[model samples]
Target: MLNLLSGLIGLVTLILMIPAVLPLLGALNWILVPIALFGAFIGLMSSKKSGQYFCLIVAGFGALRLFLGGGIV
Candidate 1:
C-alpha cells in the first residue's frame, strides 16, 4: 500500500523530471526535489526498501540537476 503509493509518486515525479532536464527548464527541479522526498518518506513506511530507494534515487538526480544548474538554468 505505502510502497504502491510511493512508486506512483516516483513515477509522477520522473514524468515531470523529463521536461525539467531541458537547458532552460532546470528550475522545475526545485519543485520536483520536495515531491520526490515526500515519496521517499511514504516509502519509508513500507516493509520493503525498493520504493524508498527508487524515490531517493530520483530525488538525488533531481538535486544533482539543481546543483549542476546552480539552482536555476
Candidate 2:
C-alpha cells in the first residue's frame, strides 16, 4: 500500500520535473525535491525496495538539477 502510494507520488513528481528542466524554470526543483523526498520516506515504510529506490532516484535527479542550476535558474 505504502509502496503503491510512493510510486504514484514519484510518477507525479517525475511529470512535474519535465517543466522544471527548462532553462529558466529550474527553481521549480526546490518544491519538487521535498515532494520526492516525502515519497521516498513513505516508500521506506514499505516492505519492498523498488518504490523507495525509485523515489530516491527521483529525488537525486531533482537535487542534481538544483546543483547544476546553482540552486536557481
Candidate 3:
C-alpha cells in the first residue's frame, strides 16, 4: 500500500515536473536538471521499498522525453 502510494506520488511528481521545469531548463541554464534529478533521487532514496517504482517513473519520463520530443502527454 505504501509502495503504491509512493509510486503514484512519484509518477505525479514526474508528470508535474515536465511542464513546470522544462522551460526553466533553458533559461536557468540547465541548473534545474540536477535539482530535479536530485529531488527524484531523494524521493527514491527515502522510499526504500518503493525506490524501484520511483526510479522507473523517472526513467520512463526520460525515455518519453527522448523519443517523444516533448513533455508528457
Q: Which candidate number maximizes TM-score? A: 2
Q: Model 1 — TM-score against the truth?
A: 0.96
Better of 1 and 3 by lDDT: 1
Candidate 2 at 46: error in angstroms? Answer: 0.5
TM-score of each: 0.96, 0.97, 0.37
Q: Report the C-alpha lDDT of model 3 over 1-73, residue by residue, as the tens digit.
A: 4455555555655655566445434233133334445545555555465644564556555554544444322
Which portions of model 1 miss their true places by more than 4 Å?
A: none
Candidate 3's C-alpha runs over 4 A off are 25-48, 51-73
Write down the TM-score for model 3: 0.37
Clashing pairs in 1: none
Cα displacement (angstroms), candidate 2, residue 67, comes to 0.5
Q: In terms of lDDT, which candidate is strongest?
A: 1
Name the better of 2 and 3 by lDDT.
Answer: 2
In candidate 2, the residue pairs with backbone N, CA or C atoms under 3 Å apart (3 or more residues apart, or in different chains) clash, namely: none
Mind giving the per-residue lDDT tens digits that candidate 1 earns over 25-71? 99999999999999999999999878889999999999999999999
RMSD of 2: 0.5
User: How many clashes (backbone atoms < 3 Å, residues ≥3 apart in a chain or on different chains) does model 2 have?
Assistant: 0
